[model samples]
Target: MWLVLAFAVAGGLAQLVDGTLGMGFGVTSATVLLALGVAPATASAATHAAKLPTTLISGLSHWREGNIDVRILLRVALPGMVGGFLGAVVLTSISLEAAKGWMAGLLLFFGFVILLRFGFGFRLIPVPKNGERTRWLAPIGVLGGFVDATGGGGWGPVVTPSLMTVTRHEPRKVVGTVNAAEFAVAVSVSTGFVTGAAHQDIPWLPVLGLVLGGVCIAPIAARLAGRLPHAPMGTMVGGLVILVNLVTVVSLLGGLPGWLDAILIVAWLALVGRLAWRAWEKEKAGRLAVVGNPGVNA
Candidate 1:
């Protein structure tokens, strides 16, 4: 009962984050389950299973809220479905120990990417004035799906940021589109996990708890999507992903010295705080400018 409650809470929290930010449900839930000694295959399977209903509700809520782009959703979701299934098959074929390492590395990479993109506003390429050409979306979808299936959560983290960078769309639209597209990815990944040859027994209790908690919060989270400040939320989520995965990597590396761990965490927190403050200041300035010059198009 206690375990079920714990997962329920975790699921609610993860869904809140994912629905608002367009990512984190799988990453957060899988991280917790892995920490609790669940197998990689099982963890990924459970995460996707839980995500099915949650993503469905989230997508619909976003659609009702006018956050979706039908063209973007179809383009990204179809390729993502294929990639997700392939990724699940690949993950299931690998040995347990290797899969853990793979997940750790993938999570760490995505964490850093999130931090760079959101926290520091790093961009590798220039943004086009109108919008990015649609040709690039298919590849992005494939990559996002592959990573999400293999890492237990990445479609949003990968697809959302990538879209935001290339397109001129608002944050709410990008987040909504990613969250909506995730329903398809979840369906494909779940199917792959079930059909995989070395399928493990899923933790159905946790899945149920996650589903219930996530469903309850889906509408609220969708409503918050257009209202919340993206920078602070993105920075916080990136920091969390990095921190949690760091702990997993440390455990895999025969553990780190207690002092070193504390120092590392403190340093990371300081960086996250600095970035978040800068983002807040920038946003404040932008709002002030708009208020000062109501005639100008901000």
Candidate 2:
């Protein structure tokens, strides 16, 4: 009972962050589930499935707000669908449990990426002209989808930053389009996992709990998308990624102390306080890198 409640809380928090920041639901939820002894395939499947509703609502909201670029959606979605399915099949064919050490490492690496990219005043290449065919979107979509499925969550983290910094599109628009595209990625990954090795592996109870929690915050998160101090949430979630995965890796080594779990709770609380108190200073950093900088692709 307590375990299921924990999963629900994690799922809700994960979606809240993803809804505002455009990533983290799958990464956060999958990490928790994996740490709880859920099989990797099952964790991936459940996380994607759980994401379906939240993404749908969040995407629709973004679209209504004119934050999505239809052309980019088509370009990314088509390839992303293919990559998501293939990735699911490929992962199901392998022994993900046996490879969890590598999986933990992968999540940890991305955790750092999120921290540095979003935390330390990171910027990237200019956005390509609207629909001018950078020729890079296709491959990136494919690769992002593949990684998303295999790792349980990489689409937003993998794709969002690249699109934001590389293309110089409006950060909000890039975020919305990536989120809209996630609908397709989530669907494809879920379907693939359902028919693949994890067909019977869905944790219905925990998934339902997560779904309920996520649904409660979907609308609120959508509204907060562009308005919130995303970096703080980004940092918070990244901290969770590192903290949780680090614990998982350690447990793999030996029995983890009960006190360490208590410390993690404290660390999380401290980060939240730090983020809230530093909001003004971080905002001065201009994390969004405003739309018209004269260096854009248009």
Candidate 3:
């Protein structure tokens, strides 16, 4: 009972972050589950399963907001589904111990990407002016789907940024299209896991907890999305993910010195805190400037 409640809370918190920032639910949830020693395949399966309802709801919201591009959605989603299914199958085929190290490493990589992107304000290549072909999106979708299924989450972090770099669409449209396509990826990944040999290992109870918690918080998250500061939230989530996966990676490498681990963690915390503070200050200053110059074009 206590365990289920704990999972519910985790799910709710993850959804809160993802809803506000438009990403992180799977990564955050997977980090927690993996830190608790869950198998990689099971964790991915559970996250994808839980995502079914949430992604559907998210897609609908974006559609209503006029954020989706139906053409982009179909193109990316079809390839994403194929890649997600294959990724799930490959992950399930691996032994748990081996899969753990790989998943941890992948999550760590993702954490760093997120940290660099939000904390350091790293920007992707500029989108060319209708010069890039949409066909290229297929490969991006394939990679994003594979990563998301194998690492427990990465579709938005991978697909959204990649699309923004090469496509001529508005940033909001790219975000919305990537999100809408995730529903298909989730379905395909879930199907793959259900049909996999290790399907029996899935933790249905925790999955139920995640689903219920995420569903309950979805509407609230949607409301908060426009209200919260994105950079701070993104940095916080990235830092947390990095810390969690760093421990896992260190353990897989036969453990780090306790003092070294402590030092690394402390340094990371300081850096993340500084970045988040700076982001908050920047946002506050921007708001103040906008208010002060009411007639100036923002």
Candidate 4:
């Protein structure tokens, strides 16, 4: 009961954040599962399975809201699906405890990329269909899919940042397209886990709890992303990505002391706060600067 409730709540919160910010669902949910001592392979399988519903709902909402790019979705999703399948197979064969460390490091690296994007106000847009730059999505999708399946969660963390840094699309659209594409990745990862891993590996109750909880909030999160101002949300999502991965990295490094945890959290909060203030100031300035003629009045 308590366990079920915890999983349900965690899933809901994760979905909400993922939907709103374009990332965090799998990593957040998997982090919690790992803390509860779930096996790595099982955790990855369960996370992928749980993502089925959340991603479906989220993708639908984004599609309806005109946030997705069909071409981008197809291009990236196909490779991601292939990568996810391969990653799941690798996870089953490798010593996951060792693999987990590498995954954490990789995620942490991307977390910093996201922060750099937000910190510097990068405005990378997508190129034309015929442009060579558009081809980069294939490799990004491949890496994203592989890491996501093996790490139990990282598609958005990896895909979103890479796309944002290189692509010419708006952040909101990229988030939506990536999320919409994630349906394929999630499905592929789950199939790999179910057929390749031990049949009894997944914990059914936790999977059910997460799915039930995530379904309810999935639409709401997509709507929020569509409506929310991009800059502020980017800061929030970037900060959160870094913070969450830092915790994971810390835990992997034999866990931190109480004071260290507090210090890290406080620092994280301070960075978000500063970014938030800057976003607000920019918004206020934009609002004040109407496009009306500056001709002399009267």
Candidate 2 local lDDT, residue 126: 54
TM-score of each: 0.92, 0.84, 0.90, 0.81
RMSD of 3: 2.4
lDDT of 1 by residue, 232-286 (tens): 7677777878888888888898998999999999998998888888877776677
True-structure lDDT of candidate 2? 0.78
Relative to the true structure, how large is the alpha-carbon lDDT of every model?
Answer: 0.85, 0.78, 0.82, 0.77
Backbone clashes under 3 angstroms, per model: 0, 4, 0, 5
- For model 2, which pairs clash? 126-167, 126-168, 127-167, 127-168
Candidate 1's TM-score: 0.92
The sequence of per-residue lDDT tens digits that candidate 4 reaches over residues 16-85 is: 7678667778877776666567767778888988899889988999899888989888989999999999
Best by lDDT: 1
Residue range 1-298, candidate 3, lDDT tens digits: 7777877888888877776666788898788889988889989988998899988877777677766789989989999999999999999999888899888988888888777777777756455666666778899889989989999998877887678677777555665677779899999998988889656777888888888788777666655555677678888888989999989988987998899989999998998999888977876777679789998633
Q: Clashes in candidate 1: how many?
A: 0
- What lDDT tens digits, residue by residue, belong to model 2 across residues 116-195? 66566454445455654447788879988988888888888888887775564766788888888999999999889877
Q: Point out where model 1 deviates above 4 Å.
A: 197-199, 294-298
Better structure of 1 and 3 per TM-score: 1
